[model samples]
Target: MGWLWDNAVTLATIVMAAAAVAALVYAHLSITENRAAERRANANELWRERS
Candidate 1:
């Protein structure tokens, strides 16, 4: 469509922004998961030492 062609750049920019946001969200979730796993490991180590 003529309107879509005229706004192609705008559409592309929006798509890129959305993708960047998604990447940031994924990275944050991964960091949180890693921290949780590290905490669990640390607790297990402490338990073993105590026992």
Candidate 2:
């Protein structure tokens, strides 16, 4: 379509921005999950030591 052709660059920019945002969200969630797992492991270790 003529309209799509005219706005091709704008569409591409929006797509790239969305992809970047998605990547950042995925990275943040992964880091949070890893931190939670680390805390759980530390707690377990402390419990074992006390027992």
Candidate 3:
């Protein structure tokens, strides 16, 4: 078990990789939300005309 505890560089690399993956996941969610909002606005405008 000491071998696993001895590699600081490997542990740092794994942490950085995990953070990068989390950032990508958040970005994907943001794009999806923005797209849905735009579609909802368009749909509302079409149905909102009083004339």
The deviation in Å at residue 25 for candidate 1 is: 0.4
Any runs in candidate 1 off by more than 4 Å, and if so which? Answer: none
Give the per-residue lDDT of model 3 (tens digit) for 1-51.
898789988999999999999999999999999999999998889889753
Best by TM-score: 1
TM-score against truth, every candidate: 0.95, 0.94, 0.81
lDDT tens digits, residues 1-51, model 2? 999999999999999999999999999999999999999999999999999
Model 1 Cα lDDT, one tens digit per residue, 1-51: 999999999999999999999999999999999999999999999999999
Candidate 1, residue 21: lDDT: 100
Q: On lDDT, who's better, 2 or 3?
A: 2
* TM-score between candidate 3 and the true structure: 0.81
Clashes of each: 0, 0, 0
Q: Relative to the true structure, how large is the alpha-carbon lDDT of every model?
A: 1.00, 1.00, 0.94
